[model samples]
Target: MSFSALPKIGMGTFRLKGNDARDAVKSALSLGYRHIDTAQAYENEAEVGDGIVSSGIPRREIFLTTKVWHDKLRASDLINSLHDSLTRLKTDHVDLALIHWPSPNDEVPMSEYLGALRDAQREGLATHIGISNFTCSQMDQAKDILGDTPIFTNQVEVHPFLNNRKVIEHARQLGIPVTGYMPLAVGKVMEDDTLIRIGAEHNASAAQIALAWTISKGVTPIPSSTRPKHQKDNLDALKIRLSKEEIAAIDQLDRNERIANPEFAPRWD
Candidate 1:
């Protein structure tokens, strides 16, 4: 998909499950969210699918993304897992499919998994393929493995508190876009004095300021919220333009406090 065709802000469904996941996705769609993010690891694809169907919106209007977990990075496992994801999503194809993370200890070579992901795209299971939680070196290896096939976007934990500069810089250098999950910093941004002050100037909430900062840097922010009001507030960040100074202030908040690093995660750059 063309970069312009992708929405800069999307609704995230990480950790949201069962009726809550379903209701949240439904509410997000009703609140004007055209992009929905979920993953096999989230274990809420069925609920997410139900919510999407219940939105009363045509499937063509939504941009859907799903990921294959780390353990399932083998060629056969990756392909089979995504097919299951498609079934659970109640869609024939996903706009984007990603390798949830690099294989732990390089157990499965990058070529194998990314090659399988490319194969899935050719099979019409995914319109595009990408990776997540990959460090700079891994991004290079992915490009080498995929050759001309594009890496759609790198979805990672990025927020005002953990700016993820290395990953973001490498993605930019490779001409790939980024999707910032946990853009609200898991409710931590709301307690920041600087973000609060910036929000006050824009008459928005601290979370909005954080989301706006992510957007200002050309990164798409998928902020998860179960509340319709909070979902609307997040989408509204698309409209709150931050000045250069405001953006700089938010940039300074990055202390490289990473989140979502599992024991098996690759060594970060």
Candidate 2:
């Protein structure tokens, strides 16, 4: 998908569950968020779908995306799991579908699963196809396997605390836009002294500063919140335009602190 096709800011539904997820999604949509992100592994697709439906917005107006988990990377398994995700989401198709993670230790060849994702696209299950949490090397392999196919975006953790510069740069070189998950660093941004100071300059909250900083770096930041007020606060981040010096200050905050590391995660770029 073209970079212009994707929303610059999205509402993430990662750790949200049940009514929380439902209400958050509904509130986000009601508050004017057009991009809604979830995952099969998040176990909240049903509620997320309910929220979307309850918001009274037409499905066609929403840019919806969901990821197939790493455990289901086997060709048939990936396709089947995505089918299940669509069912839970109460949608016939998603705007984008992604591999949640590369196969642990290369248990499944990139060709098998990526080909299946491409096949899913061909089957009209997802309008766009991409990957999440994939490193530079794995992305290279995927590109080689998928050949000329386009990658919509690479969703990865990219906060000021974990700039993920290498992944961001490599992805840029390959022309895959980066969508940052946990752009607020899971609430840590609220306590950062630099962010706090910057927030004061614009009369914005620290969270907004973090999102603006990430946006200034050409990364789309999807920050999730269970509360309506916080969701609105995140949406307001788009209004913030950081100065070059402010962006550099946030850039200096990166210390290789990755918050989403999992046992099965690939060696990062």
Best by lDDT: 2
Model 1, span 1-269: residue lDDT tens:
33344587999999998999999999999999999999999999999999999999999889999999998989999989988999999999999998998899999988889989999999999988899998888888888888899889988889999999888988999988999998988899999999999999999999999999999888999999999999999999999999999999999998888778889988977
lDDT of 2 by residue, 1-269 (tens): 33246898999999999999999999999999999999998999999999999999999889999999988999899899988999999999999999999899999988999999999999999999999999998888888988889998999999999999999999999998999999988899999999999999999999999999988889999999988898999999999999989999999999989999999999876
Evaluated at residue 124, the lDDT of candidate 1 is: 92
- Ten contiguous residues with the weakest lDDT in model 1: 1-10
The TM-scores of all predictions, comma-separated, are: 0.97, 0.98
lDDT of candidates 1 onward, in order: 0.91, 0.92
Score candidate 2 by TM-score against the native: 0.98
lDDT of 1 at 93: 95
- Per-residue lDDT, model 1, residue 12, is 94
